[model samples]
Target: MQQAINKVELRNLQIEDYKELKNSMVEAYSELKEAYWQEEQIERLLEIFPEGQLVILVDGRVVGSALSLIVDNRKASATHTYEKITGNYTFSTHDPFGDVLYGIDVFIHPDYRGLRLGRRLYDARKEICEKLNLQSIIFAGRIPRYAEHAKEMTPKQYIEKVRAKEIHDPVLSFQLSNDFHVIKVMKNYLEGDVSSQEYAVLLEWNNIYYEKHQQLINTRKSVIRLGLIQWQMRPLNNLEALFEQAEFFIDAVSGYASDFAMFPELFIAPLMADYNHLSEADAIRELARYTDSIRKKFQEFAISYNINIITGSMPLLENGNLYNVGFLCKRDGTSEMYSKIHITPNEVFYWGMKGGSQIKTFDTDCGKIGIMICYDVEFPELSRLLADEGMDILFVPFLTDTQNGYTRVRNCAQARAIENECYVAIAGCVGNLPKVNNMDIQFAQAAVFTPSDFAFPTNGIKAEATPNTEMTLIVDVDVDLLKELHEHGSVRTMKDRRKDLYQIKKLKS
Candidate 1:
């Protein structure tokens, strides 16, 4: 018997398997009053969606089968009856360009009931839904055992008991275990479902990777790769030396096909060595003079290396007032700027830096992203605002003078990732520049963080570099996982917010 079971294989339904398919369906539904599907009906299903009709065979004998069709969810209401969805078994409602996959039937022969054949067919249907980029899989699931408890409870109560594991329902329990949820309790869903007393539950399984628009060839990526440079601070003889060092790391990261490359905040502070003879405030203002030329150079590198470049944070002198700013250079030859919204006491006293008034997320080819400089990430309100704008990843380019400072930024960034249900990456400068005042020593540990859930790492850290080292941390994160967490995670922070009682509003600038 084990040897025979070893021959089990799944494939598309064929014409020659109709006889076994019909026999299996009759056997599986013997307790029900409905008749099995006819050969003509099976052929019509194949004509509509050939790949959706799946079968499992053991020792060349058909034992289980599943049938499905596509339908526009907007037209096929959740309250729709099975007959309406199937077009009275003619499948006239099947839409080739539909966003939802509708399950018609699934059955397994009694002889193969203990082999878990039905699960194989269900898994196959989910695979097809994701591959086709369907929004969800919807079906009217039967409560075959509901008649036993109909005298004492309602269908809703029965479903609740089944969900809580207090009751054992063959179909409902199995569906619940497979990550499907009841959308609604439907009545008169099937013509002769006597065991369920013509009652059924509408079930749905969402495809997390679903996108609104359909493309013959999808160019947008669901997984984005990141490269973070743990830069080392050192004196540079000229601006040309800085460009050469930047290109070396850019070329290395782009070689690995990274989508974005990030540098530490104030990474170009070494250039301040030329003006170190002046006061701290005077030298930083002089450092601001190089911002424009450096931004242009990074933009050229972004286009040449085919990677988005986050130019850390530089001194920006505007109208005689200094501001800490960062630039996002896209591979398409476009550039965007974000200013630090919060100023540290040290920055204010030494450089007389003023805070920027705006905070927003940036649109990138990979996805929506947010940038927060060293001190900006320490404040949760700024990140929460970006989260409202649908930020997928938060990049923190920091320059910490001590391990305590780095710890503050690290812990806060991790909290932002969990609270916002997004990814957070931190890159910072290490080593030292003794000649440059206020930049003498640095501490850093670059890391990528994810939401704490089953789909992510147990500790929530995707990858982290060695402490105070000059190296790159490369990691890939799936944006689809964020979609799942927003809707179905064990702890759904975004969905469970008490907006009725309190809300976070973005005030006008």
Candidate 2:
């Protein structure tokens, strides 16, 4: 095999590299007096917590090192000295179950000053923190070279200058660039230290990848605003007229500052201009023909308005087969389709349409969501599967001709929300189109729902438009509150699921 040309590698420190490590430390910190760690201390650190000790090598030569130890943040105070915190460099305060990773030291050889080896060491420490599920990494970063400008400004003034990009301190500047924020300045942190003027700055980097058992709470802009439109039946006109109407509603919702705008199932029913002249089967096929053009327009609106839009559901034609599909258009003009997985009897007998075979969830900036059409929301298994896969919200677009038909979809939607502990929003078509044959009549009411828990609304209805009316409703749903309900609700529906007795697995694709 050819010798690997990659010169740099990171690995755990070994017991045999103490001599080289001592020499490297001396070469890296040559300007400081007595800065090298003792051989016994290095050996002890490797013996007790070898995983926390990392070494950087260039062609098998140890050129840099980073050491860390876990410490309980509760026991640490705002003004503790370095010697008191680390137990005189022995790290006797290391707690295995602690939530914070304390940085002991980091140094690179003089030859590796501009190679960014220190940044590599810091990234390695972050990787360790994530793997261990640590909350954050805290360190007493030095203001090295501050002694050169100590008489010119105080420590606070120096930090402000470094933050404002007016002046730079070697260690503090590097830490700030690496996403570390200064917490406070520690007095008498290191005795007799010329660098930092014997004062060290406490800094922290939160491990965002860490998974905590507690629910996540958001303090800033926690709600996702949704605009649901209950479209009224209109005459079958040209495609341009239909598109203009959709843009009208989308523009209206955008003015209200909605994050996501949703329409009803088959909201494009009025665009089927040639339906009355053809048979029922031909009419359904005609609807599929407009899928591509409508999809492009929907994406354009999403990008132009800078709002995410769901095209309730469209009649799509795929490889000579007709399917009821919905297009989710993101703010960047990207889109994905979700075909209705449960076919109704009317669709099967009259239109010869088949049900979709696959189910999927979409991740958005608002939240993780699953889209279901009219009849799909009536099935418990589909929504439960989506909830199990970490769906926090479910969107349903329905079309019903009678009050009884509307009640079925609305009741089942509420049941799914309660059972899954997920937010459910339903939008539907209203009014009647007498000349449109099968789509002549519609009775609907748009509603946003939530779980019937203390954390959520009491009756599970957040907002609802009147039945048999043309209207739009904009409501806010909190994703963080859904997380809270999943973990600590009055009745934990997700957690209380009896998985031991029954397992519902998705069929192989």
Winner by TM-score: 1
The lDDT, on a scale of 0 to 1, for candidate 1 is 0.92
Per-residue lDDT tens digits of candidate 2, residues 236-297? 56888888889999999999999889999998888665676887678979988888998999
Candidate 2, superposed: residue stretches over 4 Å from native: 1-221
TM-score of each: 0.85, 0.61
Alpha carbon lDDT of residue 162, candidate 2?
94
**Which lDDT value does model 1 have at 326?**
90
lDDT of 1 by residue, 408-490 (tens): 99999999999999999999999989999888999999999999999999999999999998999999999988987887799
Q: Whose lDDT is greatest here?
A: 1
